[model samples]
Target: MGLTFSANLGFLWQELPLPDAIRAAHRAGFAAVECHWPYDVPAQQVAAALSGTGLRMLGLNTRRGGPGENGLSALPARGAEARAAVDEAIAYADAIDAGAIHVMAGFATGQEAEAAFIDTLRYACAATTRTILIEPLNSYDAPGYFLTTTAQAEGIIAKVAAPNLRLMFDCYHVQLMEGDVTHKLERLLPIIGHIQFASVPDRGAPDHGELNYPHIFAVAERLGWPLPLGAEYKPGGPTEPTLGWLLR
Candidate 1:
């Protein structure tokens, strides 16, 4: 099968609302779309937009605790809040028929944070039919991010060991934190819930980066991974014009 791609609405199409962004993604030839947090807009509205556009709503992240907060999944003191966030994300994802949900780890550390991460992931895995994703953010962008490397993520996944709990291996972040992406992608393909790409260092687009996206794509293809590579990057300007890579 051919490679597929998801438009990350969190950064792309900033000018449009959630509903319009879905439509824009469809027009741009994306197989699916994802958002950071769409709770502000009613789930029904986003669902309608997806139905109208014939585009899949891939997945979305739970709410970040607000300004200065990255996420809540690793906060040991906020277990109730984290579980509640899971329920809310489940409702929205189910409403829109999204197949997955990304559980953000935030900027947390230590034994407490690890315990919290395990507990939150366990709860989310038990609560929803949709796949739960755990991503490792780069320190430069998310300093003190709870999960920072594939090995760390693997260890967490091993501890959680939930069928539904899978790692979200983002190329941009992984490349920044650890180089050897192609091998890592091959090694982690079985448990990767989602795959995302952007230009390394700057996060401009998939092309013109320190890492070669085409080679990575080739590696994923050889590995027989069957999912859309999410275009999770800052357009640097307008999202529409930066999509020349798609045509190429």
Candidate 2:
């Protein structure tokens, strides 16, 4: 079977509005789409675009805590804000019929942060039936982010003990922080809710990167990954021209 891809509207088609981006993804032959933050756009407009284009809204993230905060759920002192962000994300995802909600863990550390994260995740899981995801960002890209490794995320998932909680395994971050991407995929397949990709080092389209995407995609197919892999890369210019990688 051929590999399918999801256009991360958060990066692609930056020139167009969110609704237009959904339409653009469909025209480009993407099977589905995901985004980082769609709260600014009206959910009705986004839903209308998804309905009109016949594409699925894969996932979205919660709000940041405040200035310089990448996320809120991991901050020990910001439990209320964290839960509020979770509530907002759940409501937005419901309006758009999104498949998952990635709860971002801001820059924090220690057992307190982990405890806060677990509590917030429990609240999020109890709040919605949709799958909840936690991604491990590379230190180089997101220094001090609470979640930084799959092992740590695995432990947290175990503590949360929610069936809907899963990992957002972004290949670029995982490869940069730790090698053996395919092996991790094989091992973590049970906990993986969504898979995302970008060129290593540069975070660009998959055509030019240290990691061989075709090989990785082939492995994903062999492993029986259920959904379209997410293409979360920077176009560096007009998104349309940068899409040669998708066609190739």
Residue 27 in candidate 1 has what lDDT? 93
Per-model lDDT: 0.90, 0.94
Which residue pairs clash within candidate 2?
none
- TM-score for all models, in order of appearance: 0.98, 0.98
lDDT for model 1, please. Answer: 0.90
Off by over 4 Å in 2: none
Q: What does candidate 1's lDDT look like per residue over 113-198, in tens digits?
A: 99998999999999987899989989999999898999999999999888988989999999999999988998888889899999
Give one digit per residue, the lDDT tens place, for model 2 in 1-248: 57789999989997799999999999999999999889889999999999999999999999876788899999999999999999999999999899999999999999999999999999999999999999999999899999999999999999999999999999999999998998999999999999999999999999877899889998999998989899999999888888887888
Cα displacement (angstroms), candidate 1, residue 145, comes to 1.3
What's the true lDDT of residue 211 in model 2? 95
